[model samples]
Target: MRIGLLTEGGYPYATGESALWCDRLVRGLAPHTFDVYALTGDAGQEPAGRLPLPPHVRAVRTAAPGDAEGGGPGGRSDRCGYGRRERGRFEAAFADLAYGVCAGDVDTGAGPHADPAERFAAGLYALAELARAHGGLPAALRSETAVRVLESACRASGARRTLAAATLPDQLAVVEQWERLLRPLSLDWYDASDGLGRVDLCHAASAGAAALPGLVAKRFFGTPLLVTEHGSRLRAHYLATAGAPFTTPVRALLAAFHGRLAGEAYRRADLLTPGNAHTRRWQERCGADPDRLRTVHPGMDAERFAETGEHEDSGDPATLAWIGRVEPAKDLVALLHAFAAIRRRQPDVRLRIIAAPVRDADAAGYLALCRSLAAQLFPAEAAGAHAAGESPVSFEELGSPEAPTLEDAYAAGAVVVLSSVAEGFPVGLVEAMFCARATVSTDVGAVVEVVGGTGLVVPPRNPTALADACLALLRDPGRRHRLGAAARARALELFTVEQNLAAYRGLYLELLSHAPVRHRAAPGVPFAHPAESHVPGSWADRPAAPATSAPVKATATTVAAAPGDPDA
Candidate 1:
């Protein structure tokens, strides 16, 4: 089947969310042709180029959100003002969105009859149609007309107090952001033959902006849409917009837009695959049909850690290891504090903070802060720490001599530690599981789901709970071994690439079975006739009266007139 893989700020890019796993999935399901429709974010991700793709990926069409603001020279989006009629259309569609958001008409758990969601979708698609017909929105959405519509909506009757109180600046800010998020609607990917219309299925690798193309494809071409969310898009929007220097009006507006979009995506998608049950619940709460939802855990390559996983003996008996990026969300400071508490109980134990290479300035600063905290907590001269220039807390890279590979990093610890205050799939935790290492993780995001009772989970940011959990695992070798074995078993059965591919392979065929066959030939779109192979009837059960009819064998004329013969 031809799959249109839709992604945002990831996949094909060297960085971004869902890139690695999506690559693994595309590589694994190589039999199917993929046409990637990727929307990159504001970071100029295209400059970084893309990851090497397998041959099955027929096309990789990458566009940045920046494209929405332009049409190059002599194009429709050349900062040319919309015509009077075009202005009317733009205003009406923009008003539907602004009014829906302003009045708080967004519904999280509503059916198709829900007017709020209906209006949101109607407005979204209307704008998409306008872009398709007019070449693109360009400056229309960022024009004064849009801001006027938003201001009018805020002051309209039944609008929320927070939105109604929005100032001019707030309206402008919201308009700018709204235009940014709506970039997908203005893209050239809406072409019927060369774009998403040609694909059999639209596999949206994410929701929100990434899924917008799939929504359009399904609407225009009857394309089957499959949306997969490793993390909840609406929830992420809420988290990102909170305390983000925006007024309540801006925040509420952003949240409402994302909520409405997510609800629409859930309602229209043929299937919704969340990476974990935690994400599944988020979707359900956001009005996704329970029947359409499926949980597909993120998959990793197990063979990378196979030798280490199967080994009976690996890693230091007295060490706890933390492996992941050094970000504030990872809560390295909390982990250091927890290690301080662990040192009080067992002075001989060591804590290793193995971080992936970080490029962001903020991440570098956060890493530096963690190192400083570790120093203050465990001074070099401290008697209880490891001897001979070794501190109790050590920060090292994954490829360093001491930890040559990811497996080596996991192997350096008897118990893997995850101290993130926020997480998605807990990939590192699963990697540790694959390496057959016992774990102590914070109970946040999908940590509990991934751990699944195999490892100890403590509340986030609680040094006491974290320290206690680590000590328990460290002190009991037999318990540690049992948990490690169980974790490895679970990771192998559920989190490996093979299992993930198998699940998607089945899901792909299942979706196609229900979808109408799409044809490229000139006979025109035909009936939705399904093969009746399963019906219990003589048609299915009867052996041929072939022997009776065999006497009427093919004559020369009949043979000449066979289906494939050119001449009769």
Candidate 2:
């Protein structure tokens, strides 16, 4: 099967949220071909180039969010050059879309037979079709006319009160953002011969703009779409726009747009796969059908940590280790306080913080703050003996002679600690499990689900609870040993690369079996029939039995059945 893998700021890129997992999936499923459609987030991401792609990847097409600004080679003219009829159609459709956004509830009742969701969907697709027909969306989408239309919609009756206070600047900001988010409508990737229509299944790595093309493919052609969300796109958008510089009305309008998009994507997808239960619940709240939702955990390589898992007894019993990118959401401050508490009880205990380098300047500032806090919490023991009895807290990075790799960092301590207040999948905790190290993680995101009773769980931002949990395992070697053993087993069973590949392989075939097959034959072909098996023996001439009651419907059982079965 050929898969169209759609992503934003990830996969093929050297850095991004879902880059590693997407790379692994493409590499693991070698029998299937992949065509990647990536929407890049920034200019810095392009300089790193892409990860080496496997042979199964047939093509990589990328577009940046800024591509809609009308300054590039394919950018449209500033005047729009719309005919009178086309201008009227554009005005009508844009008004409906903007009004739906300002109203705050895209599916709410405008009337008894209104169907607001259908209105939103109709307006969006109408604009997409218009853009396709005209070669691209007019630069008018980013013009003052667009902002004026948006302002009018905000002032319409039944609009939210928050939208009533929107000024010209706020309207302009919203229109600019909308242009970027709707850029997919101007792309030429919907053709049946060479674009998304050629794939058997369109798999969107996340929602919002990345899934926009997949949605278009399903709408223009009869392609099946599968959307996977490791982190809820709606939730991320809300968090990012919460305290942004935009006005309240602008924020509300942007939120409503993303919410409506997510709802539409959920409604149209043949299947929804969330990386964990935390993400699954978010999707459910956004109106995803429970029957279509499936939870698939991200995979990690267990073989890389095999040596550390086998020798769990080698780490220092009095040391606690924390490994991950240095960011404020990780709550490194809380971890330092918890460590101080642990030190008061056990003075000889040490903490090693192994941080991964990040591209964001804010994260670097956070790392510096963490270092200052560590120094303040643990004062140097006599200035001259800084090396002799150095502060028990030490910050290190990977690739140093002391800790060369992630596995080496996990091996430096008997218990791994995670104090993140906000998280997605707690990948670092899972990596600890892969190394057979007992963990003490705060209860956030999917940490509890991933741990599965194999390690200690404490509430977020509670220093006392975190310290106590770490102390409990530190004081009892037998309990730690048992937990570590169980964690290794669980990680190997459910969180390995092999299990992840099998789940997706099955899902791909299941979706394809139900989808209508596209005929790619030439126009002159008699029946437009694809090649079928032809046996050149006596059995080929035998008449087939024709009295079967009816064909059996395919179920999950039949779809997953082994080959060579009569029913198969």
Candidate 3:
């Protein structure tokens, strides 16, 4: 089946979260054709170049967030150029949607035109079509014409009083926000010639920005969309403070719009795949049908750390290793306090906080704070400690020559520790398990779920609890060995790329079976195209043949299992 693989700043790009997983999925499922529609965060990431494309990926198209319409904050006031009829329709549609957001009522009156949710969807499509027909909506929405239309809608009954009373600055800000929010509508990706309109299904790698294009594609064409959220996009955006600088009213309004869009996407999708039960719960709360949701954990590459478990820990096994990006969210402060408690119990115990250098500003600041806390925790220096190279707690970067690589870092200790106060998948925990290291993780994000019964899970922000869990593994060598072995086994079975590929291979077929195809070869192509172009036109009409004698490498089906027909 042809799949429209939608992503934002990832998969195809060397940088970007979830790039590795997306690459694995594409390469693993070579039988299904993938057309990639990637939205880049900036022009700098473009220089990183693209990842090696597998045979499954038929094509890739990219655009950037920085290229969104209205290059300047002041350019939105020009609207004299739009014709009267088109301007009126555009303004009216936008105003109706905006009113729905301002009033916080999806069902304005339950009618097609008045229903707020329907109005928003219809208006979003109208704006997209308008942009397609014209050059784009950058200048149009920024225009005074758009503002006047919004003003009229706000004054109409059933609209919120605050919207009607919005100051000039508020009006301008709202218009600018709308332009940014609707930027996906202006992208040139909704035509039949492009792979988007021809794909059997659109599989969005994430929700929010990455999924925006999928929504647009569905609206433009009758394409069925499948949105998969590993980390909740809405939650992540809220946590990351994407547009926090805006006024509360503006933020709330935009939030409502995103919520509505998410709801609509969930409502229309044939299926929703969330990476964990935590994320799935969020989807359900946001109106996703319980029946349509599936939990699929993101696969991890486990082969690299296989050598670390070759020997059991015996040499000065007092080291506690913490591996992950050094961010405030990881709660290094609490970790330091926990380490101090461990030191009080076992004076010889050592703690190593291995963090990657901060690439982002927030993380840089957080790392500095963690370093300061470590200094404060281990303030007293022994007279001969400098020569002996001994410190109770140490902050080290991942690539330091002393440890060299991540595998070496993990092998430094028998126990891996995760002190994150906010987490999604706990990649660090999985990496530790791959190295056959027992883990003690704070209860956050998917930590408990990922660890399952293999490791000790403690409550977040409790230094005593965290310290005790670490001590349990530290004191009992036998327990550590057993837990480490079990953890490794679990990760190898469920989290490895091989298992992930197998799950997705089955899901691909399952989705194809239920989601009718929308594409077909031209008149001159090999087989008869199904009326529903997404279906295999010839496969539908053919009688079942005896098993095939040759293996189909793409499907991983063995030849010996089937006998007779060439194309079974």
Candidate 4:
């Protein structure tokens, strides 16, 4: 089967967990060919180039907003110069989006567009049709005309209080962002000859901008769409924009758009695979069909930690390890405070804050603050009598000689720790589990779900609970060993790349099985082409006779399967 994989700022173009998962997905599913439609989020990603791809990936088509993130705060816009009729069509369609955002909602409506979600979907597709018919919609979306329509909707009856409070500049800001989010509609990927339309299924990496194209493909060509997100996109947006400088009105408008888009995508998708129950709840709350949802945790490669798991008793009994990116969200400060409590209970116990490579611009500052706090909390001079100049707390990078590989990092600790206050899928926790190590993590995101009953989980941001949980495993070696063994078995059975591949491979075939089987060679069918069809030619009328006994010569009848045979 042919699969169209949709993504944003990940897969072949970037590194880290999201990209790694996408790469494995494409490579692991060797039976099905893939066509990747990637949307880059950063300018730097283009220069870095793509990761090595397997032969099964047939094509890679990419787009940046307007050549370079167009129509954003400081980016160029794709000008769609619409004449009179086109302008009217755009205005009418855009008005539905505005009304849906400002007023028409589940609670307030009684008409043809009673459901605000319906209004939102209608407007989104109408604009998409306009873009498809008239090239694109960047100029119109960023025009004074769009601003006027938004303002009028804000003042209309039944308009929400927050939206009505929006100022002119706020409207402009919202319009700028909307144009970027809707940029996928203007892409030429829906062509039947050699693009998304020809694929048997559309598999979106997430429900954000990546899934927009899938929605369009399903609408245009009846292709089945499957959206998977290890980290929920709506949750990320709410977290990022929480304390921004924008007023409530602008935030509300943007949020309304995001929510509606998410709901529409949820409603239209043939299946939705959220990474964990944490994410599944969010999708369910936003109106995803309960029957269509599945909780598929993103898998980790167990072989990466094979050596560490094999020698489970190698780590120092007194050491506790924390492994992940050194970002503010990880709450290293809280971890430091927890370690201070651990120190009071046992002076010889050590805490190692082993960070993965930092990516965010603010990570350096966060790491610096963590280092200073650790220094003040446990002065080296104070511990001179016991460990002889060792402060009992150490900071190291993953690639350092002491902890060179992933296995080395896991082997450095008797008890692995995760102190994140806001996590998504807990890749580090799963790594610890794969390495057969006992873990103590904060109760956030998918930590509870991923850890299951294998590891200890404490409430997030509570230093005392975190310290207590770590101390329990540190004091009892036998319990640690038992938990470690159980964790490894769970990881091997439930979270391997092999398991993920099996799940998705079945899902892809299942969707295709139910769909109307259209031949690639079927002429005059929409989105049908000769791309994957067998080359037509004349064949022998009858099967060749069997070779005579003792005759060693090659014959057509001796062949295992014939090329043009109907059964073959």
Candidate 5:
């Protein structure tokens, strides 16, 4: 089976969150071919410096978020502006989206007839058609004409109560943000030249902006889309919109837009795979059918932490180790308060905060705040020579002689502590599990789901609960050993690249089996194994059914004969 691995700011890019896992998955599934459709976020992720790919990857095509701004040359397939019929469809669909959002009629929940899903799908396809005719959607979605169209739609009958209450400015502000975010749908990536229309399945690494093109491919080419979200896209959007400088009404309107898009993705995708149950519930709430949803945990490199489990353990017996990017979300303030309690109960206890390598300026600020808090917490203890030498709490970067690697960081403590008030998946907890170390994590995001009773779960921002959990693990080495063993067992069983590949391999064949082969050759061309298959390691070496010829017109555009097409 051929798989179109769709990603945004990841995969082929050497510097994104999902790059390593995606590379591992593609490499593991040698039986299938992959074509990477990467939507990068910046120039730094240019394909020229992409990760080394395995032979199974046939091609790598990329378009950045920046591409939607029309910053470079005009798109290759641009036609003139839309004609009357297409323009009508675009106007109608755009109005439906605006009115649905404005009126609170956008249902981001499961129901037999959800208008948000319909609105998003209709608007998306309409935009796609418009982009195919015009250069792209930039001029159309943001134009004065577009805003006026939306207002007209809001006043139309069947519009929601919110629309009736909304002013013209509220409507325009919402439309502007929606247009900017939905730009991915207008790209030419789904055309015949791109492999998107041809693949047996389209697997998006995450939801949100990255998954937009996959939704388009599914709509335009009838591609079987499989959307996987490790972090809940809707939740992230809500958080971002809340903090954004936009007005409350604008945020509400954009939130409605995001909620609608997510619902559409869930409704349209053949299957939805969230990394954990926390995200799965979010998807379900956002209108994903329960039957089509599966929870597939993100795979990680277990081997990297194996050595830490075996040797060079965290030396302080009562020490609590925090490993991850030192961001405010990690809740270092809470960790410090908890550690203070631990210090008061047992003065010898130490706290080791492991900081991720800082390439981002924002991370530097977070680290500084953590350092000041740690100093204030232990001020008298570190007032004189101790401050200059060894402190009770210290911030350590990833690579140092004292804490050389991730393994070293894990081994340096008896308990791995995660105090983050906000989290997607506690990646640090998984790393600790790989190192065969016990963990104490605050209940947030997918923490309880990922840990799965393998560690101690405390309430978020509760220093007392956090301290008690760590102290329990510290005092009982036998309990610690048992938990560590179980954590490792769970990680190996469910969170390995091997397991991830197996799941997708099964899904690919399952989706294909439901659709009969629709790309058989012409009358005289035998459907037998081709000559290339006879080359030792190919399918000719394996047993096969006899050839029977019955031509089926390829309904999918990507079915056009490539170099190795069975029909050719």
Candidate 6:
């Protein structure tokens, strides 16, 4: 079956979230054809070039948010130039959407009207239809008339108080952001013959902008949308905008718009696969159907750490390793403080801070500060007869001789430590598990879930708790060995790349099997010809497989339970 895989800032790109996982999935499921629709975040992400795509990818279409600058789909010269009638249509639709956003109230309770949600959806589809007819929405959405419509809606009697306070600049910013976020509506990827309409399933790699196209495909062509969110995009938006320069009203309005979008996506999606329970809970809070939600953990290749897993005693008995990008969120400062406490308790203990490449200026500054703090905490000793030149707290990169690779980094310590104040799936912790190394991680994001009784989890930002956990592991080699062995067993059983591929493949087949078969009927033939069979096999000699026009029915048993269930 052909799949329309949608992504935002990921996949095919050399750097982006989920690039590796998406590439692995596409390669693993070589039997299916994929049409990639990528929404790049910026120009720089593609400079290093994309990862080599597998042959099964039929085509890849990329669009950046900056594309909205040209006014619309075909550019400034090809603007839709809406007529009086189209202008009226745009006014009504845009007003409804803006009102729905400013209202800031969607009935998410049981059996509620969901009027705000429905209005937002209705206005959204109307704009999409207009864009499809006119070749783009930029010209209309960018007009002064659009700004007036938004202002009127925000000033309406029932609007949120924050929105009523929006100034002209705030209005302009909100409208510009909406234009960018809604750019997918102007895309020509919905045609039945050549675009998303032709695919059997629309798999969105994440929510928000990337999932918008999938929502459109499902709405227009009845294509089943499978939304897999590794991180809750809605939550991310709220966090990201917390410090934005925009006015409170503008931020509130934008948040409402994104909230409505998430609700609609969740409502329309046939299946919601969150990478972990943390994301699943966020989806559920946004009104995702409990029955439709399934937790599919991100997969990692264990073979890369197989050698380390087999030889658990190779690492230094006193070293504690922290492997990941050095960012503020990683709380390396707290790690440093905790390491100081560990040193006080055991002066011979060493800490290896294996830094991944920093991605931004902020992270670079943070790394420099961490280095300075390390110098203050463990100043280099003089080169005496038995003195080592290296600082007790060493910061090393991936290719360094001490930590040649990720597997080597995990193998360089008896206890792996994660001190992040925020995380998604705790990929590093899972990698350490794959290496069969005991871990001391902070209780953040999915660390507790991923650790699953194998590692000691401490509260984030608490140096004492972190140091105590590290000391507990350091003081007991037998316990570390037991936990390491158990961790490897759990990692192999639950988090391997093969398991992820199989889960998705099952989900795809399950969704397709239950979906209505789209086929043209022959004249005067009532079940006389077989256009397509729902079941797999050569059915040329058999009668047409029974077709049901009923909505797809999913039983409680349809989705497998989370992996490693005791009963199983």
What's the lDDT for all of these models?
0.81, 0.82, 0.75, 0.83, 0.75, 0.84
Worst 10 residues of 5 by lDDT: 71-80
Over the stretch 1-568, how does candidate 2's per-residue lDDT look in tens digits?
7799998888889775489999999999888889999888776777878999987798998887656435243433344457878777777777767876776553455453255556667778888888878766647586555777889988987788898898988887788778778888888788776788778899999878888899889999879999998888898899888878877878888898998899889989999999999999998987799999989888888999999999987799989999998888899999999989999998888888988866689988999899888878877532433868566888888767778998999999999999999888888888899899999999998888999999999999999999999999999999998999999999999898899889999999899889865534333334333322122334432233345533222223212222321111
Model 5 segments beyond 4 Å from truth?
68-80, 83-86, 106-116, 133-135, 154-173, 311-315, 385-388, 520-568
RMSD to true structure for each model, in Å: 7.4, 7.0, 7.1, 8.0, 6.3, 7.9
**Candidate 2: Cα lDDT at 464:** 91
Candidate 1: worst 10 consecutive residues by lDDT?
559-568
Candidate 4, residues 1-568: lDDT per residue as tens digits?
8899998888878666889999989999887888999988776787888899999888898887665223444533333368889988999899988888777465554677767788878888899888888887777888878888899988988888877678889888998888888889888888765777778899998888999999999988888999998888998899889988888988998888888888888889999999899899999998899999987878778997998998888899999998888888899999999999998989889887888877677898899898888778877534573456455788889899878888899999899999888988888888899899999999999888888899999999999999999999999999999999999998898889999988888888789888764443332343332222232233322233345533122233322222332211
TM-score of each: 0.87, 0.89, 0.87, 0.89, 0.86, 0.88
Look at candidate 5 and tell me the lDDT of residue 251: 66
Clashes of each: 0, 0, 4, 1, 6, 0
Candidate 5 vs. true structure, TM-score:
0.86
Clashing pairs for predicted structure model 1, backbone only: none
Model 1 Cα lDDT, one tens digit per residue, 1-568: 7789998878888775489889999999988878998888655787777899998798888777577645322222322267888888888888877767666653545544236667678778888888888878757877788888889988987677788678999888887888778878888897765788777889998778889989988888888999999999888888887769988878888888888889889999999999998899999988889999989988888999999999835888999899998888998888888888988889899888898888889999998898778778877535444556667788898799988898899999899999989987888899999999999999999988898979999899899999999999889999999999999999988888888899999999999889865433221223221233223356542233454353222223211222321111
Mark the regions of model 1 whose C-alpha exceeds 4 Å error after superposition: 69-80, 106-114, 380-387, 522-568
- Which ranges in model 2 have alpha carbons more than 4 Å from their true place? 66-80, 106-113, 380-389, 522-568
Sequence-dependent TM-score of model 4: 0.89
Tens digit of lDDT per residue, candidate 6, span 429-486? 8899999999999998888889999999989999999999999999999999999999
Cα displacement (Å) at residue 474, model 3 = 0.9
TM-score of 2: 0.89
Error of 2 at 263 (Å): 1.4
Q: Which prediction has more favorable TM-score, 1 or 6?
A: 6
Clashes, model 6: 0
